[model samples]
Target: MKTIHLIVHGHIQGVGFRYFAQTTAQSKKVTGWVKNQEDGTVEAVAQGTENQLQSFVHTLRSGNRYARVEEIKVSEADQDQTYAGFKIIR
Candidate 1:
């Protein structure tokens, strides 16, 4: 398993971006936490198989019809984060 840091940009705030991400991560059995950034972006750190992480990123791009994600910055994280389930951090 691996940890990936994702920064999603564009019309993502106040449009259920965090919820969608959390739900998607859970459905994929991924461990992570998502939060709204101060710069109006959505941020998440997902830990799972590489394939699962890719799928999660794909969902962030296409699964959200109501939320238009313009760009996503993804990178490998230094360590694995233990999370029982995905959540939207306030």
Candidate 2:
């Protein structure tokens, strides 16, 4: 198992980025949360097998047409065993 945090930049606000990310995470059996940042970036955490995490990142890199994710910053994260499922944080 692995955990990763990602800050996605460029045209990531509105346009259902959080919803898309949540859907992708659920389908991939990844657990964590997604939310908007104050600086117009999208942030997310994914916890699961390394393969699933990689796939999730790939999907984020090439988001839905409505979104244009120009860059993503990823880092290791502490385990969050309490997270039950993927969601859009308030």
Candidate 3:
């Protein structure tokens, strides 16, 4: 199991990116949370198998029909997050 942290940049806010990410994560069986950052970025943490994590990140980058993702910053995250399911944080 691994945790992937992502800071998605570009016009991601107010575009249902968080909800899109949550749905995508759930479909991929990735557990974690996604939220809007103050810096106009979307921050997400996903934990799962390598394949699942990869797919989750892909979905985030591709975004939904409303989003226009410019770039995505990826990094490792602490494995102790232990989220029960994917969610959108306030």
TM-score of each: 0.93, 0.95, 0.95
Q: Please provide, for model 3 over 1-90, each residue's C-alpha lDDT reduced to its tens digit, 9 standing for 90 to 100.
A: 999889999998998889999999889999999999999999988899999988888777788999999999999988875889998999
Candidate 1: segments with Cα more than 4 A from true spot: none
Model 1, span 46-66: residue lDDT tens: 999989998889888874667
Better of 2 and 3 by lDDT: 2
Best by lDDT: 2
Worst lDDT 10-window in candidate 3: 54-63
* lDDT, residue 82, candidate 2: 50
**Which prediction has the highest TM-score against the true structure?**
3
The local distance difference test score of model 1 is 0.86
Error of 1 at 28 (Å): 0.9
lDDT of 2 by residue, 7-47 (tens): 99999798989999999999999999999999999988889
